[model samples]
Target: MLRPILFIFVLFFFKYTYGQNEIYELRVYEMEFFKPANILHDYFEKALIPALNREGVNNVGAFEESGETLPKKIYLLISYQNMQAHQDVTDALKNDTQFKLDAQTYWETPSEKTPFKRIESIFIRSVSGFPNLDKPADDSEFFELRIYESHNEDALRRKVKMFNDSEFAIFNDVGLNTVFFGENISGNQMPCLTYLLAFKNKEEHEKAWSKFGPHPEWQRIVKLEEYKNAMNDISRIFLKPLTYSQL
Candidate 1:
């Protein structure tokens, strides 16, 4: 009888732990044309990513903007099981011997001569509707990172509710392949939410979005009074995965 009770407790603990929402750190490296990004790429491909994997983080995505633009930027997505897990990884990296050795080159570089001018990190937490980052099964060539900024906290809450209550289902029906959805807990834009979508190509992206606006369910819910003014601004960026990117 004691053994059975212990087994039940273990089972319950496993379910609760695995069902918890995730935390994500989106790091953006802003680079100037004068500096080459090879060192930065090398550190990620050779040192940082591998170190994170050893520490039990998986599916780390490294990407660059799809088109050439001034001040080129690289995007890195790192997911943690939870806030505590994220803190643990951070503390562990400091004492990771192999990680230090591999990152020696980057560490030795002069600040003024480094590959990137600055780094911006955005912290996010998974929403109820999307509790984990979903790696695409298909070979996705194009990616979209979108952010919706709300006018206030209440508006942001409503927008998140719309996603949980209806928008996510509509996205599935319209063929919008989502990678993740989270609310920004700490970042440049307050009261904002961010999400990523993957597609086979630009044509597929256009096709999928074309279906979303006219979908009957979307048309109906979008007009609901509760959701009005839920978002005041939207920002989007197109990205392509680097050769070593896991996502």
Candidate 2:
């Protein structure tokens, strides 16, 4: 009730506090493996990594989703606190001789077609008030956050059934505010599944978890032998809006 009002108030207050500059960070999704993921990984390590720093790019790292659990097993996180600052690299790319050469070898290789095979990018704006809302689901959570790094196609279908059971069971039994849940979609380098929680704000995210954790129903679910190993590695990150985000 009060949260929506607060979000609006904060949006306006924070908007002008920085003098109309809105910040956003792009979560670049590099989907599909480049024939040989190892080679592409090496290219990023050798070329893209140093180039980003030399070009004054902010934060860059890759999160490998557990291929054993999901078909989509890669997640890469790139950060930019200010959008206008983007020109620093684009400008450098125009003038940097060494960077240009590295770029050509890394990206424009004759045999290498392209880094991204198919891209499903999503622009996520921070919910001003919820800071750590990105964490995995709690007992009282109306939603479920399950990520999978699959090894084969058959397991993907199995993973889907497991997810539906978990999320649906939570909602039906717990009376929690489970509204929406979906995989984080993108043109990703490593394929993995990601789910977001829709809480009122940061406070409720905490409250829901604390209550959910000890609930008898939740404890029972957690102890189910069938659900013993659902995720390989579940990592969550928060993105602050860069100065360039339109919303």
Candidate 3:
């Protein structure tokens, strides 16, 4: 009887702990030009994404920066159940035979013919207020990726606090549909947080921000002394999902 009771307690504890949040990996691949971009796209569509799916990661999102631009880039958002799963999937990829065979074309490309100049990877832990990544609707056409940079760790904490305590609520009130809100656990941009928002079109994107600025809750939170100057700089990028993107 005692053994059964102890087993039940342990099961409940593990479920509560691991079910609390998801981990996200954001990968950015910078291309030198359009020609090489195709190679990267092919590899993602044929090799990497399928391999991830086999490993139980089902919600991989692939996106390209919007508009006609030179020196293109691709963004991939992959979600995991936990930190352990993230590590395990990565380790498995390194030695997976089928993945290697599938990715052979990309692997065999010469240095001169390589598709991307470099890849930037950032790991994020889901915020408590928004613990899971939301999958965008099938008809969703545009995404706005925003990164808020804080001056110091204290300011970063406060900015994140403001989001948890009030801003996320106001965002929902104003029609800023969130995809994910994550604190950067490891990345180039220190003392910052990154989030993704989805919209149906450019017109809708513009209209949402218009509503957000003057919303009462957002106004009140911004005026708070503790939250003042929490963000030093902001970076915004508009993206359109690739045909195969799962987000």
Candidate 4:
């Protein structure tokens, strides 16, 4: 009993000191050509989201590409309080009788009739500077998801530090509203950091970015020696929230 008490105390101290950073799961579903998207939508709206909310997870985000493309993509973002919460919630779902019943239609659907051809999942940990996901404004209809890939682990570390030390404030000054910023913990991109920005529309998106390039703070930080060569590549995708999206 003493050992268990000590262990619990250590865990509590760790979380309290570290600001309780959240874990984000980003799931991308690539839809089949002829399959209806509504099947997955129904499952998410009527079953998955509700079950997750009951389990104390809320503000789930569902989105799609701003433009139509082959093999349509559906993006889902779920946030967990911590690593332990993520594991516990996942295990609890397996034994959730109501969740099982609600998900019956999805479970009974034939393989060939399934909505997606494949599902890709990426897990991320919130950055120290940005410890939680923020819901976008009511008028925020456009979002940009950006991934910065570094040449190596050290470079990735520097890039993340750059964001923490100066870039986040610069972004705020320039009116580039942030939704979330995180380091990819498990995904295809090994040495990368990902972040999302929200805007009212395309024009607002363009306008906000226009300020970032010429801002005095940005100009000064971009020339900082420590951050030089911190990133080698960037991938940007524009997304729009689905009708049922919570963020």
Winning model by lDDT: 1
Cα distance off (Å), candidate 3, residue 212:
0.8
> lDDT of all the models against the reference?
0.93, 0.45, 0.89, 0.91
Off by over 4 Å in 1: 1-16
What is the per-residue lDDT of model 4 for residues 87-135, given as tens digits with 9 covering 90 to 100? 9899999999999999999999999899899999999999998888898
Candidate 3, poorest ten consecutive residues by summed lDDT:
32-41
**In angstroms, how far off is 98's CA in candidate 4?**
1.6
lDDT, candidate 2, 1-247, per-residue tens: 9999999999897764543322323344455543545545565566665676676553453444322442333443343333454545557667877766765655655454544454444422222222212222322222233345554434443444455655445543443443223333332422444444434445665666666667666677667765555445655533222222111
**Candidate 3 vs 4: which has more TM-score:** 4
Model 2: CA > 4 A from native:
1-34, 69-73, 111-116, 130-247
Task: Name the Cα RMSD for model 4.
Answer: 2.7
Best by TM-score: 1
Candidate 3 versus the native: TM-score? Answer: 0.93
Please list the residue runs of candidate 4 whose C-alpha ends up more than 4 Å from where it truly belongs after superposition.
Answer: 1-18
